[model samples]
Target: MMLHAGSWRELDTELYSLTDNNTHVSIVVPYTAPDTVFEAVQSDSIRARVDLLLLETPNMWQLNDLSLACNFPLTMTECYPNGTVTALAVKVESVRNLNPKYLTLSDRSCKPVFSNDRFAFFSFNLNSCGTTRTFFDNVMVYENEIAMHHSMGKHQSRKGLINPDYRHTVSCYYLVNDTETMAFRTRPRNSDPKADPGVGQLVVQMRLAQEVSYDLFYQTEDYPVVKYLQQPLYFEVELMRSTDPRIALVLENCWATLHEDRTTLPSWDLIVDRCENLDDRYIVFYPVVADARVHIPAHVKRFSVKMFTFTTDETVLKEQIFVHCDADLCDTTKPDGICSGQCASPLRNAKPLKPTGSRRGIAADISQHRLSSGPIILSDSSNFV
Candidate 1:
């Protein structure tokens, strides 16, 4: 007899009764197994629910116990201005049976730079590793796709096929550094016997704080990454000079732009004329203070802004944002110091500083320069809460 469970079975029985000389056995079976069908449907629904849960919480799955043991953290070590090349480094686990012999950056083999019992390091040049370069407005971006190939010696066996390889990609942006040559003012046709003192060299550096405390920062990573509309970004801009103690750093204006060119259209003002932008309620300008451990000078300026992106009617440009600041070195000791401690608004008519030759004191000799920092990438909002 055929059973509803998709199997055939036979059963026999003997009657041992005086009244029952002959007996017959009858088997009954249902057309379908209702329990089995219900179980299959329930299992499919459970699988669908699990898939939906994974989709909703993607990061949770990444941190699950079944995740791979290795991690890949790619970082840009240095960017050569002259050659337009960038150096990148990556760290990976150094498991005994899962050790990788070498890494491939865009198909170019890169030997391990350093190795230890716990981790192995790999370094490569973006330009020489078959990297692809693209231009976004005035910014130049380089992308390198890297892969790790495990050592074939241990993986030669058929069981080795079970192990998985690792792959990751990172993009590096090229931006002008803080060091800039001073554009000295020209001597006037009619000037005093004492020639005008040339504006000395001034170096400006911008850094991003790693936490809300605004103390620890990613000083090495020139290209910092931030989350979208999740956390506030703290920035510290410092002016370095050794020529004169009377000189003070003044940030005239600061703004954010989608492109590398600060003059590009669709820019958002962070600080205008030494004052925070009134339109952005999330902007907070921290008082300038000295921190010797972080190399922050006593005349440093710091500010924090909530993460944001540039939007337009056509489309929302969320690739990368750059921060640019127009700063000047002012002689504070002068009687008529050009560095007005207040904002330049309609109510306050602050006179512009005259040319170095026209003004008598060094206060008028303003060394104005534009400093930039970024290619700051905003993480996808879906990645976070």
Candidate 2:
């Protein structure tokens, strides 16, 4: 669906890039094991799940499939042979903006119930190392707040991540409504000085991860810099594929920070037209060449696709699968599928409109794992035996 509401407003703002400190970060997705094992266990046995862990260190990163909820520790193997994570996935340098950074994550309850097509992305900070400051007020980042681990460690005396509270809302950001606007009513923080005094510096780090086919556009709320809803915005998009169907695409607004601040609204719009499934696709891998066929998720608002190559070797030939959202692939009948290139014409029935930047990726990498490891099921498997 296209949005066409007319000229847009611009907000004055500031942007800054954060430097990477060279540490590995891990994102763990847990799942259940298989039906075979369930047969041996009694009918009353508790269920177990599997964990798909994605680990990213400064120099290298890897994906591992581990079985959880089992009495025995099942060895988790490295999905990648060389243990090299695509640079695209690990090179996300943390950014620091003059404005306080916004931190947000998809709620646990919001996990895509369908095909894992929630356009999922999250922003966060890292404290892979122990702390290095000396004072109760030295904590810049909260246990789960958006503050940079670097900034927080700079103030505290005690070492190690001192998460005083984790139950509270860990993310210090808000989701922009579909109306295309974010209102930041900055009030004195809970740790503000004058009254509470010496609560350390409040620094937020910027990190964004989103699926392909969507363009995130930003404009301040205060300028005449109008955006025509009928035209597509310019952006730089990149994609990275893992051994599994889940891939990640990053969109960085190359536009310099505009100076206004009433309320800034950045928008992410689905740009691809539609799709037609031509073949049973496969993911290919080689030196630097990692590509996967992305399946059109059931609940995605928009779909788009781009191709990337890393190796000149033919071994990279179709080791993976991916979904494309180009115009040719997407038509009136298949509005959800995207082709690999830009659409030839505007979607005949759709128009572009202002959007509010928001949340959050893949399935091909999924099938490969299932095929290699046998079918995965978290529910009880005893009946099968």
Candidate 3:
């Protein structure tokens, strides 16, 4: 059940290792009832066919109706509302763009591999209020043996990842008015598609100004029953343009507090490290800014961002990262967006600038004192200019 992707040679090697004699394997995509979906896929009696399952929501089952397609849709339906698992008797065609093409029923033994940009997962936890959804932002082998097997949260307790002690909170922008007040100016304009910069043009421009932020939770529980401590998290902030449905480039900046001893902050050593480390119950604040000209498509429901985090262990740490505007109008105490911390002095007009050397790595000259804790001064004329 473990799935992987690569060139033909690499895939051949993997298949050889799993089943020495590479047989003519037919790939099947199944949906509905995750348990029964796996049962049909793992049956050894079904020779000559390798079963794949695409997990889907109940509301979207119509996509699995492959009775009319010429060939199996990109996905194969496993279990229907009835006891039928795989509707092989009826002609089932694969639907292109549907995901999770494979499933391994054996928990420890069968692992699933997925292709890039093909699939993503949503971990749903239902509470009294409603269902809160947490999305794992990628389609890859997420190493969560404990949770997968024991139904116990393991990723949250892992050591080197984001530990259990982080405060998790999200800030939102909502339009609050008197209960009886009527909102908005006019109905959306309708225009001909043939016209230039039609109604779609203005709609897209305004949507780009708003940015969204969300809190990440590794494990889900009822809102009232949860307790949180402070820790670091790997943040993946992406700008979703209205023109495109995909999540665009991910932000690279990250921030965390000093270690438990206040000696030094944790550093990322991997080729690409996303998680930050911090003390339990500690507070780390970082700012978020939007360019205001992000170039979005016409139709946008909510300009919201989705933040997700997972540890290799089972500890839950609550975290809060405040996002604000880059303008100088924010309060001095929580300057989430301002460029000049809380300086009240009238700003001097500086010329357009670029870094020349190593300083290029850290180019925001928001301070004249020192770049970091380093002793490099702005004007080393020893005496004040």
Candidate 4:
């Protein structure tokens, strides 16, 4: 008998069966797991993962996904079916990790009434009620790993890393933190007058967990001129994995400081794209910032952004970290030429949209965090975090 649009599919134990328990079938799927998302979640740093399937289905139709038992049904309008593809993501990150009953679906936020006792690759099929076909040739599965530990500690302290003698062959000074913490800064505190009287100071707190197994992407020691993004922007960060399922890698208390007034950059929307684990050494992380703008309309020349990384009870969370360096190293005349090469950037290819100035960084007005204007058009003055 031909399975109609609303017909339920049987258990699939064959090759394309995405569920760990071989629960249901998702017909017309082109690629299997490793074939598509292998490299994405192949990092040891990734503890979980789910496929972000980009799909193009029949015009003005919804998906008839029968992978899970009681899947909260979903329908798509294909409103602008200009050959456009919608998404049908699965919560496979918790595949074998969680009880089958608690599985999640991209469409249904609440648990389904008839959940399959297994894990399924978020798959979409033709609706039994409708005759629209769902085609997914190109797909992507993003990995979202989180830090289960408390705040990652700072290995380099201003007092501990200072040297009296310093010299340089290339640039005068080096950046305190890498891209990992590029968007991090602390709020202005009246207590420390000498330590950056106002805002715009990137907190120099490096988390020393090299052995913790998380891949990081940062430009060379020579930092980018602090660019401002007048438009909203998003960033990615790899996080340490959590051993326990209940504890999610969560981020909290995030805001940006304007350069001119040292005020907070209001948040219109902060989205946590993923909080699951992938089987990769490093998880691909992305967050959505609908509006990365200030409450006021004034154009910002400089600013500092701030956010934190840690584990919490929330199902969806993101992470970020930053650190400060010893200002004493800036003198360029400190001790046994230690600060010279220590602060110099290696001879690598020129950075994208390299800053014209030879300044240390974009935040020149502030203390050691020498920031300069660059291409990304980021909000400015003294942006941190």
Candidate 5:
């Protein structure tokens, strides 16, 4: 049958067999019959197409079978941190009657590392294999798709049966673990920050206090709502995958602006020179503490600022605020190092201190990484009513 204008119409008649039992009745039909209807469906990621067969009854409709569909199992075989990269392994069920040699990932040449008659296995770094990374609700998502391409052979050609190209795809999703490092880089001074390949990342977020003693702080929404001049906004900056016990995180400077463009006019300083801005009396810094709730390496820094808006000529510009911070990683084992300094007055013509020790035996130059969070909307207290 075919559907037309919200109604089903009988397209043609076909031969069928029926069986009746005391418990149930079954009807069997040939899938290769001329009257068989197959509906094309786009897979969840819209990266693949599937053909579905439907069977209709008196009161309901049911999917008959996915025999002609490309719906195959995609499983994560392994996911673990491997030094500078996250090692990942995935397996896909090979399409029946399709050569496994033609089955590969989005990068057409990325063939399966291992394969049998039924399943094809792939292994690579998470950053490889044509994986695309995106951020959703503060969580990093990594996605990779596998595809199978097949064309009918000349020997199988038949009248009215075209040898059309057949393409099937299935996608696999992986979330970045907290201990895994993301490939991100800090922007040059006075430029916009962006994600780049082959660099460590620092995650900065605005959080809400859940318990006393800073034991439990939950990340707020990407664009958090706040009350203007009535509440304080808390923030945290963390270095990803800081598994070494000797490493420490430091925030060298932090500021807020009315726009995502950091260089926009009318920026406000909350912290400068590793100290709270002297002009912002309401700014508060929370000491980094290690406990069951927080990670052991102490790669996190926290602070809070009372909500306020940028004002000019006594006119308040109640725009969403974007907070940005320059951070660095230091070796806490080094005595009197960059991380051990106390908040003091900003010095004139003073050079910024670099981290003193190595990480994982690699003596690479540690630079200040910049991270930003927000678009924090400050609503008037009266607006709540």
Candidate 6:
């Protein structure tokens, strides 16, 4: 058993292990240092909902019993059999002061020993072997309405990291109340009587980092897939939400290049006009086509759509979305395929075509192909219908 301040400690298991062999283990405190500072208050009684998960070992030749408690007269059950974890929400109220002699130990053969002087302590009910080591994680201690103490890991780095600007439009909606100002930071010590809102900040950072380097994003919550060369797609860039609806956002670099052509370095062009501006998030009714050049290709293509956003006169954000083009994922029937070069002929070469379908009076040159759909009328019913 280890004595951190004035109380004994027992640490087990490796939670947040950084390496495959749990060699690079580090612990990040959820909250700040205690208000009492480094003073060892043996009488600082606490009430905790301890969650002790005991992982089973492959060797089952011998079975041992392990138990854990903060107070001498621990409000917990004795050692349970092997291959099972213990979860107890003990209500350890104000107990008397404890010292080195107050240290609680097992009178049995395998006496508990102290390894480190961290916050919480751990015990094992296993036969000592090269791989048989106790692992404890998520040891949360609460008192009254505040989360008093939590367990930390071994050989932890005491380095301070700069808080990253995890301000993505998508995650910012849930992280910050106002995007333009980025206000309302979450605090764990608040008097809200709820779990730390600081977790939401981590969630926002994780989401931004995860999507930025891992997966692609799109304006629509649901991204579509198109059949390559057989279909056409209309992709766009839009804001998730806006703090001010009056401020205009100009989008640029609506460009794409096939995955296969990424190495060969294909030419890139704007998917939409540079002057197009978005006043609101819901201004998407007609989709903006991705074909920047008049001559588009027909092939099963996997490409990315990258865009830049400018608020007022300054560039604010730049993002990209990944997509694949194939017939299997085509969402529309009238997909403008790649440039065939045969249909570019002059319309004067064809004779004046007469309307033969139910819809008449629609005369056009056959060479200039187009598509239109409506309720068809009978030849004699045009007068009434």
Clashes of each: 0, 62, 44, 61, 0, 19
Q: Sort the candidates on TM-score, descending order.
A: 1, 5, 6, 4, 3, 2
Tens digit per residue, CA lDDT, model 2, 183-269:
787677777466645643211111111222332323323222222222222222222122222322211111111112212333212
Q: Whole-model Cα lDDT per candidate? A: 0.52, 0.23, 0.23, 0.24, 0.53, 0.23
> Which one wins by lDDT: 5 or 6?
5
Assess every candidate by TM-score. 0.39, 0.13, 0.15, 0.15, 0.39, 0.16
Model number with the top lDDT: 5
Q: 3 or 5, which is superior by TM-score?
A: 5
* True-structure lDDT of candidate 2: 0.23
Q: What lDDT tens digits, residue by residue, belong to model 4 across residues 1-385?
A: 0121123233233634343235443433332333222112211221222232222244524333222111223331122223322222222322222233333332233233443433222222222111233223443212211111211137534433323121101101123333563566789897856654674322222122111221232333423323233222233221222122221122211122222221222111111111111111121223222233322111111112222111124211132212211121122233333223222112233211211112122211112321211112233434534
Each model's RMSD to truth, in Å?
31.0, 38.9, 31.3, 35.1, 24.4, 27.6
Q: Which is better, 1 or 2, measured by TM-score?
A: 1
Please identify which of the two predictions, 2 or 4, would achieve the higher TM-score against the true structure.
4
Q: After superposition, how far is residue 108 of candidate 3 from its true place, in Å?
A: 54
Which tens-of-lDDT digit does each residue in 52-169 have in candidate 1?
0111143333321111111223333445555443333323222224433445566555555664432345555665667788887767788766465544455376554324445555
lDDT by residue (172-290, candidate 3, tens digit) is 12222325766787666696457456442111111111112423322223212111222122222233333442312211122222222212323211111111122211212233443
User: 4 or 5, which is superior by TM-score?
Assistant: 5
Residue 22 error, candidate 6, Å? 90
Candidate 2 vs 5: which has more TM-score: 5
Model 2 residue 124 CA deviation in Å: 58
Could you tell me the lDDT of residue 359 within candidate 2?
Answer: 28
Off by over 4 Å in 4: 1-216, 219-232, 259-385
Which 10 successive residues of model 1 have the least lDDT summed? Answer: 46-55
Q: Give residue 256's lDDT in candidate 4 (0 to 100).
A: 20
Tens-digit lDDT track of model 5 for 217-307:
5554534655465667777776665577677676777777777876665677667767876655667777776677567636777777766
